[model samples]
Every structure is written in structure tokens, then in C-alpha cells.
Target: MSEHGGDRARAEAWLGQDPDPETRAELRALLDDPAALADRFGAKLEFGTAGLRGELGAGPNRMNRVTVMRAAAGLASVLTSRDDLRESSGGVSVVIGYDARHKSDVFAEDSAAVLTGAGVTVHLMPRPLPTPVLAYAVRHLGCAAGIMVTASHNPPRDNGYKVYWEDGAQIIPPLDQEISTAIDAVGRVDELPRGTDWRVLDEAVVEAYLRSLARLPLGTARDLTAAYTPLHGVGGAVLAQAFAWCGFPEPDVVAEQAAPDPDFPTVAFPNPEEPGAMDLALALGKGRDLVIANDPDADRCAVAAGGRMLTGDEVGGLLAEYVLRHTDGSDRLVATTIVSSSLLRAIAAEHGVRYAETLTGFKWIMKAGTDRDRLVYGYEEALGYSVGGDDGVPVHDKDGIGTALMVAAMAASAKESGGTLLDLLDDQARRYGLHATAQLSVRVEDLSVIADAMARLRESPPGELAGRTVTEVDDLAEGLDGLPPADVVRLRLSDGGRVIVRPSGTEPKLKCYLEVVVPVTSSPEEARTRATGDLTALREAVADALGL
Candidate 1:
């Protein structure tokens, strides 16, 4: 008997139901290779709050036609079982969208078919669109659910299936587990009923989403010269149209990445946070007032100004200040994640607006406040922002296109005042102290390395870091500060420096978020210098303690 004897049976079963000929051939080849067969069939991709994401391949463990089909059917089963949802919505319907990744359109089509076959009405996007558009469509079309086929900033050969509930935010908690259970119960892809009678949406859906952007409270100063890049993804055309519609000058887009290219040839990784990912865009931004880059699906926004890429926390602070000043709402709320800098909370306090800190990701950011308090603005340290319109949150997810418009508007207003974004940062420092932030990430080949490091810390935590006394240690897995339980640990120094360590939800990396707040007693520049030094020392101490 072979070591992969069980996997052989699973692989053969998967091969029989896989709809894609490419994947079927790959699986047939893997059958004779025991190692590859076991890898493909050892375990399935676990679906959770974020939905399914993995390398594109031919087995249950990888993201492929069969995997997507099972996920879609599972979601459909859950939606159909919701009698209350059907009664409230008149019927269960879903809006489906996809990006330009490999087989994204096919996956979208298959999802629509599966859902429709399961007696759920499907309104599918006419073409590949940004993930935010789908999020907005879920609410605009009054859908019970939404699905987007995109891996966001992942590498070329990766793809994903992201689920959004009727509230237009990513699914969370019990719902995710319920859908996962349904997926596990799914027997075979070929046996799952599929239909092609779903409705294909028109340009009206896209136009409606754009109209919501126009409602953003942008000032009249639209004289900003900007450079933009979509990082060889699907955001370029829509972002251009959004800028023009909002009365801003058309930005100088990087020619190499102006069009949607799934291969993402210009950069090693399509994500703007990756090293050298924005090199070309930054080069083009030399003489521009601002530079903007969006991830592949345009769900996250990154900005550069004065030839420097501003950290996500800086952008969040600026945008929070801008929105609070321009918009008029008595019960407005601003929010950030636990890993993000605490600057927004200070800004919120100054403005007397409600504030919250949630677990990382826009899913938590979007659900920051209660129904009484509207979420006027929310952001995370990972370049994701969800800014509310004049009415309410038009898109209840991270919208890079909407954020680009706001960034342009803010830049124009600042330029008109004869200052740059750097000046605004200095002002923020003087008013609210220098809240400097940095990150330390360790990418691992084996996931257990991360588990081992975490366990080591939990068992024997360092009493001090960087010569500062460890005033408090928060085991986030025990759920601190009214937030849900998470695989995270936070260390707070007596001097007010802080460190948070957690496994990256989207990648194979363990990350540490560092913050050092310094009072601006001297000049803002001097305070920044001191804060930077403290953060560096803190980073080194954390690295030594982790022993990774």
C-alpha cells in the first residue's frame, strides 16, 4: 500500500468533478506522484470569516473550480435556509462581481449558476470590476448577500472568494462557520445543480456606485496634479472615471500599470506595501502633488506625497481630520484597528466624535459603531479605508476609488493653502503629539514556526523591552478591551511605547505593529526624531524576545 493511498481516492474523486480541463489534467498527473497527491488531498482549504483564499491548483486544498463551486453552493444553501432573510428581502438574491485574475470571470459565472440553481436570484456584474463596487451593489440592489472573486493584493497565481452579508461588510463569526459547515457537507461539484439563467447587470450598477462617490463632501479646490497606478490590476479605468466625475484633473497614470494585467509584470508583488511595488509610480510622482496606488481589486488605497510614501496611519489621520471638519453629523464615529496607530482616537476626541478600536481588517472597521452612531470614517493600518458619504457609508467596505477622490480633494485644499501633506503631519504632531509607528514582519516557510513563536511568548513573556518596563501585557486571545478573541499579544511599555504581535490573516507572515508616542515639547521635527529612535529600539527588543 502507498503512503498516499487515502489521498489517491480523494484526488480521484476531486479529478472526476473538477470542471476545468486544465485542473483535471493536473490532478491526473498528481495521482502518480505520491508527495504531490498527498499535498493536494491531505486537507481542504478551511473557510472562515474571510472566505476562501489559496494558490490556484487542482485539489480541495487549493483554489480551483471544484473549490469555488462548493463554496458557492454552501453559501447558497445557507441563504436559502434563512426564512427570515427571504421574508424580509422578499426573496434571497445575491450580487456577484469579479476582478481580472485568472479564471475570475469563470468563477463568478459559476457562482451565479450555483446560487441560481439553489433558488437564489443572482445579479452579476457586466464585467470585471473593483471589489468595492460589488460591496456597494449588495446594498444598492438590496441583495441578501454578495460575492467577489478576487485575491486583492496577493501574487499572480493566487485567487479568492470573499463573501459579504446584506450589510455590505465581510461575513463574520457564526455566519462564517455556518457556511463552512455547509461547504463541508457539499458532496461533489458535478452533483451540485447549476443554472445559467441569472441576470447580467448593466452599466447602471457601476454608475450608481460612482454617483455615491460624487456625494462625498469634497471641497471646491480641485486643482491638484496627481499620479496614479492600479498596480496592473482592475482599478485604473474606474479610478480615472471617478476623478473626472468628481471634477479633479485626470491623473498621470503609470503607463506600464495603467491597464489590467493579472500577471503584474512591473512589480514582484502587486501590493503597494511590498518593497519596490510603487517604484515606477513614485518615479512618475516626482512633480505631482500626490501619488495614489490601489491593490489589484482596488479595495485598499496607498498614497505618496513629496516623493515619500506616507504610512497608512498618517493617511488615516489626515483623512479623519478632513472628514470631521467638512462633514456635519452630530453622531459621527471614527475607527481604527488594534494594530493601527492611536492618532485617530485623539483626533476623534478633539472633535468630540465617537471612536472605536476593533480587530484588524475592514470587516471590523465597517462594523465599528452602533446604529445610532453612523460610522463617518474608518481605517486600518493595512491601507484600507471606509469613508462615509454625506448621507451614510455608501460602500460599506474599503474603497480605494472613493479614498483616491478624497485624497485628491484634501491635497488640493492643502496645496491651495500653500502647504504640503508634510506640513499637515507637522501640524498634527504639534497638536496631538508625535504618534510614530512602524512594522516588523517575519515571513515563514512553515506555519508552525509562527505557532511556536507565539507559544513561546505566551509561556514566558519578557518583563521589559528596550530598557523600558513592561507595564502591561494583553493576551488578545483572551479578548481584551471588549474586542473578540484573536491570536494576538500586546505589550505596553511604561514609557507609553507599545507592541502588538499577530499572525497575518492574508499571508504567511507573523507581524509586529510598533508605536511610540512622544510629546512635541521642542519642534515637531525634534519630536518625530525622538519617536523614531524609540520605535527602532523597541523593534530590536521585540525581535530579540521573539527569538524567531
Candidate 2:
């Protein structure tokens, strides 16, 4: 069939089932607009490890009622088809959770209706909560599958749905592809059955989760004051309560951003790592001992200490040391993504803790500590941390709330030692040598540009960088370790420096992750100076190699 004709037919057919007047009108206009039609329907949104994320509008490309319902139906179909999943004393069960993004609540309800109508048992969170809460609930409830409605730190106009398997981690490999296949085969939305029998969970889950938070104390003084913000997200209230319940001083919340607003009026980008996104929190934290922030969904944590907003790598290194300081490294593993700084490896080795590097994301990191290994903590450079519970219950995802609690405790301990978090970082630098890292991201008007750049680099493989010979290049297109294959290229340099370039899994950009290490022979400051100089030159060389 002609692609344009198919788009027109699909749009006309969707109008028959679309219940929202706004979306229906939008689709009707697209039927006559060929370019708009093609843009919306030329390709269906592919469901991968990250699930579905896009702008909110009409048509197949946008996030709307029909797309969510179809995703729910597809997920329901997959879970019910698994014979082992159905053998539960009850029927196949799924848990649904959503954050405070626009249309998130409505999408959650639609999922409940579709899953219940598919003859599967469904449990819905009573309120919009953080992604980690949903991820924790999946394992805590012993459900066969889970869905979280959130875009994490994306802009306000966007929303998404992330799928979790029985392990409570995001779906990977054949599962994501399988769910995509199911979604592709879904019939019209009106033909799908909708029901209201699914269970809506009470505060029991939240109460239990808070109680679990109470057990994570590391003998740190609770004397530290933290300035905090939730970036106009739903995490503010829950996080505040969790800290108070844990007997820590009440954080000074950013009044303007304390409440949940779907528009995210306070920040240009809701992500904490973005420039100026933490300006309000930083301003409020000026006189405080620590500044703590969570991305809109509270699944990621960011902190500023001693008038310095620490990079994600620095926070990760501190947290890794904190975890290792408290526990005997026996049978416990600490992990980070391949793109993250190698400082964690130094700390882990110093404490005799096992360390593993996985493909980016907590899904792979979580598995590294599962079974006999038992992961005590894991983090990524994008401000995501998963601090394992000492009681053997695995969170299996990056948890901002839990990590925030630990960050507070870690800061308090540092204060008790008559120093700050900065002092602790210096101690690590002196022991493990200084590892400085930076990222070069090229946001493109066309995604094809990223593809072309990656192809060119692969074909012409640079032999040198920053006056140093390039020792090795691993074209990760084929796969690495036992982890799944990904479209990434990694470069190893002679001076203990490294670089990895890959297309972002979620955003439309090519990201270059660069890191360099220098020995701390003279002083911590000298080590930083040397590493910074080396990194700047490396950045230019890398940019030249990618023709950026």
C-alpha cells in the first residue's frame, strides 16, 4: 500500500475510536496534510528498552490515548500468553504506576481498563508517585509485570510509558522486541475491551515503602541541614516526609518548586544535570550544608555541597565510597555504566569489593549484583543511583529517594569528621588518583547526522588523540561482555584516558563520554589541574575526529 494512502486511512480509522475531541480534530487535519500525515504515521513509535516516549499530540507518532491503550493491551497479551506467569495462585498480574506528568493519570487509568479487560489482574497505584516507588512495588507485590507512566527528566510537553518484567528491572532484549510485536498487531482502540475491575492500592504500599526507608541508617549524624527541590515534580512531598520519618532535619524545600505542576514552570529543562536547572535549589542551598535535588520523577538524585554543585561522576564516587565504608565488600558488588567514570573501580578495588561495568542503564547494572553477587550499590553519571537495601531486598532500579537519604547521611558523617563532602572527594583523589570526565553532546536538527558521524568515525578509526597514541578501539556494534549488543564505539588512550561515542538511547543526540586520569603526586589540586588540561585538549581532538 502507498505510505501516504495508508497514513490517511489510519488517521480516518483512528478518528472512529478516539474519544478526545482535541486529538480527533488534530487527526482530521492531518488527513489532508500530506507532510503532517507522513510525519505522524510514516513509522510507528518503536517500543524498546526505554518503552514509549514522545510528544503529546494526535496520530500514531504522538503520545495519545490509543497508543497507550494499545501498549497496555500488548503488554497484557504478552503476560497472559506466558504459561508460567498464569500459574500464579491468581491470574497473570500487573502493577501500574504513574508520575505527575501531563495526562499521566489518565494514561494509567486507560492501562488499568485495558489490562483488566484482557483477563489479567491489575493493581494501580492510588496516586501519582516517583518511578522508583513503582519499580519497588513491582518486586514488592510479586507481580508478573509492571508499567510506570513517566518521562523522567524530559521537557514538560513529553510523556512516556516504561515496562518492567517480573524482575522489576526495565524489559531488555527479546522482551522489548516481543512487546513491540504485540503492539504492532493490536486492533483498533474501540475494538479493545475496557473494564474497571482492576484493584487500586491503598497507602499500605507507601507506608511499607517508607518503613523500608527507615532501616537505611549508616550511623551518620543527623545534624546536617539540606536545601532541596523536586523541580516541580511529585517527589517533593514524599521525599520530605521520608527524611522527617528517618529522623533527619527537615530539608528547606524550594517553595516555588515544592508542588507538583505538570507544566514544570520553574525550570527550562526538568533534568537536574541541565545547566541552570538547579539554579533555584543552588540559591536556596547557599547557606546550607548540602543541596539535594531530585529530577521530576525522583528516580534520579543530584546534590550540591559546600557551595559547589558536584558533577554526577563526583556524586557517584562519593556514594560508592560511602557504601564501601559501611559494608564488608565480601559477596557484594558495586557497578556503574561503561560510560561512567572509572573512579568507582579504584574505590571498589581499595575496599576489596567486586566491581562490574554494564551497558548504560540500571537494567544491566541491577543484574550484575543479582543472585549470589548481591549488589550493594550502583550508579550512573546521569544522576541515577541504586543503593541496595542491607536486608537483601533488591530495588533493581535507580532510586533517588533512597539515594537522597544516603547522601544526607554521607554528608553528615563528613561533617562529623570536621570536613565537608569536598574533603572526602580529595581523600579519594589522593588514594585512587584523580579521574576527570566530561561529555560532548551534539544535538542535531536531523538524527541522520548522528548516524553519519558514527559511521564516519567507525570507518576512519583515529590512531591518536591529544598527542597520545590511541591504544584500542572497541566498536561495540557487535556487543560487549555478556551484555546485549549496542550501537557504540569506545576508544582507549595510552595515558589512562578514554572516550566512548554513541547515539543516546532516549534523546536525539550523539553523546561523547570522555575521561582522563592523573596521578595525585603533588596535591589534589595539582592532580585536578593536570587532568583538566589533558581533558580540554582531548575534547578538541575528539571533536575533530567526529568532524563536529
| lDDT, residue 52, candidate 1 | 92
List the global CA lDDT of all models: 0.91, 0.88
Runs of candidate 2 exceeding 4 Å displacement = 1-5, 446-448
Q: What digit string (tens of lDDT, one per residue) describes model 2 on residues 215-274?
A: 764564888988999999979878988888888898999999999998988788999988
- The residue-by-residue lDDT of candidate 1 on 1-548, one tens digit each, is 65688889888877778889999988887788988987878888999888999899988889998899999999998999988876874699999999999999999999998999998999999999999999999999999999999999999999999999999999989899999999999988899888889999999999999999999988899888889999989999899899989899999999999889889999999999999999999999999999999999999999999999999999999999999998777788888999999889899999999999999888888877788988889899889998875576789999999999999988999999999888999999999888899999999999999999899889988999988998888998979888999999998878676899999987789999999889899899899788888988988989889987
How much is 223 displaced in model 2, in angstroms?
0.3
Q: What is the TM-score of each candidate against the true structure?
A: 0.97, 0.97
Winning model by lDDT: 1
Candidate 1 Cα deviation (angstroms), residue 180: 0.4
Full-model lDDT, candidate 2: 0.88
Candidate 1 Cα misplacement greater than 4 A, ranges: 446-448
